[model samples]
Target: MLKTTSQVRALTPDDLPELHLLLDRDPLVNLFVRNRVDSTRLQARWLGGQVWGYFEDGVLVSACHAGTNLVPVQATRKALRAFAERVLGDNVRPSSIVGPRDAVLPLWELLEPRWGPARSPRLAQPFMVLDRDSRLTPDPRVRPVLIDEFDTIYPACVAMFTEEVGVDPEAGSRSGYRARVAQLISQGWAFAIIEDGQVLFKTEVGAATPQACQLQGVYVHPDLRGRGIAGPALSAVVRLVRQTVAPVVTLYVNDHNTPARRAYERVGFEHTETFASILL
Candidate 1:
């Protein structure tokens, strides 16, 4: 009897159908990859990196999105090792590694020797999701950031980013980070509550698809923290997101963030999966 040999290779446009099927296996958890492929269709030129696929008997079983952010898609144990090996062989140094805890942790374990001393090795993050309207009343003050308020919202964006990622996004490229904030507002993806020209609360809808959308950069003004703001603010974001964006909303938070986790739970997000992130 012949055994099904396993192999890993860079996926191409011709492999998109199989890729879509793999992504569909869990749209909520795989939203990031789904959104990327939807826009780039697995094209390396457009993707800025390759989509590495693990094949068993010539059939794709798992995939990894290799770019500035390395993310795994439905990776099995063998697939995880294969991905790590493939990445190591190619000497890919992504800015961050993020995805399922089971997959990302193992994948990182394989790469850590060569890629040790990550800036932040967050081994456990709760991948929470919300499919229905938020339980709390949506804060009317929370709304899509207006394009004219770009200047007003820009500083808050930088603050949120720096605080969350532990790095100043503007350090690498001020214009680049500024442009991203503007783009989110222009797409109606940036949400915030502003009072007297001050940003009180803010968040952005990152990667999204028809099935699900993921949130990022959620923040409440430092002065406004510890005043029962997060729950209501997130409730507003979740409600607005479900209405205009996708029915399902998802976000992963560091496991140690008890306050944020409690806030998300109060707003109706339930932990459905575990995620891990290795920041470089």
Candidate 2:
């Protein structure tokens, strides 16, 4: 039964133990939150966002990262309702609301009436993970993007972002977007296959904690598609990521993308959970 004294309030560093337990319930799915907490330790001022907790009888029943991304982790229905009410009242403008399918959809239903329609609502995203290498062959050319190749790799990154998210990353300012891409490359998170100054394939370790690293911005140049290049490139990426970045690698794909799913399956990624993303 739902507790009567439940209240939604900002979580603090003192809440770390309980928060860790809650997030550790599904580390792969909750890696974003885990990474945020580990870096900020729930410090309200430094977190660059607020981590709110739903407490019932002094126990944290659910947690929400209310920032650019309105992410809920292990939220109960009661907690979701409380979160929707809180964000609605506060008028929080998150770029997206994303999480496990069960929590995200119900929470969106409560907020949509007031928040209006999303630009695109991805109702089914297969959250997949790989802890070991797959049967697919790894491409020898797949490697970390170098700093000198920033200019060469930037356009491909923008194309991938625009294609996948349906919006131009450079819509606001080209310099800013270019800098972001440069930062990813300088940090050694960006990977690609470059052939004579053209990036044939690209991806990045968007988020990583000690437990797992989440891949994002996966793309193959249009000309390279259907040449049987993606599978081996991705397999090489998975192998490198597991060896150097994290023991396990994870990513979520739009359910309807059969070719992407089949390619990931070839890389030995297995479905672990369902995720929903509402792009605002």
Candidate 3:
């Protein structure tokens, strides 16, 4: 019943339902599904880009997506290696975000030998699920960030990216990282907690599918840490999502981020899986 590795190609319109079945059947990675992962988004990331699939007797079977360089270790490793060997005609590096518990070790096992130990960075990959009925008491200053706040919001995004991921947003400026924030704001997807007009806490839905909204780019100003700002900021975002659309929200945290994990538990997210990101 397994498909061979040769059928992988850019997703076509006919593959949508099958792709959904693949993602939904995955107990460990269901969080990858978001409302934004509609046909258009899926086309851009999985089809327009270099997504590959393995087919057996003309039926699609194993496939791996290479959008962010991170992937489910076991399912995609063989397929990914195939893509690297066949498609790229050389070994390639992929974008990686911290992954969940289940995929972590296997991914590490795959990446460590090739990239060597020093190239690997330890990350805590924690995912959180929300109970829609939960209500977080609001912070008086907490509110949805507005379009007009772009000037301030962009710098906050820059700081968070640089400090957490150690990347300069300036390199991608031409790609409109600022404009992305503005779009998130316009869609009521971004939030900020401010006191005396100074923003203190923030979070955004980094990626999404109909089944879940993923939290990413979460940051609290260092000065405001330990004051319980994240709870309110995150609560507001969850509230918005629960109120407007889906009943559940999910986020991944680094395993070492005890503070963040603790904060997420306070808001009602439970531990799910372990994942790893290896550079190969």
Order the candidate numbers by TM-score, best to worst. Answer: 1, 2, 3
Residue lDDT tens for model 1, 240-280: 98889899999999999998999999898999999999999
Query: What residue runs in model 2 are displaced by over 4 Å at the alpha carbon?
Result: 1-3, 44-46, 173-176
Pairs clashing within candidate 2:
none
Ranking by lDDT, best first? Answer: 1, 2, 3
Compared with the true structure, model 3 gives a TM-score of 0.82
TM-score per prediction, in order, is: 0.97, 0.95, 0.82
Candidate 2 lDDT tens digits, 193-241: 9999988999999888899999999999998787888889999998888
Give the count of colliding residue pairs in each prediction: 0, 0, 24
Q: What's model 2's lDDT at 269? A: 90
lDDT of 3 at 211: 56
Model 3 residue runs over 4 Å out of place are: 1-7, 33-48, 73-91, 97-101, 104-120, 172-174
Give model 3's clash tally.
Answer: 24
Best by TM-score: 1
Q: After superposition, how far is residue 188 of candidate 1 from its true place, in Å?
A: 0.8
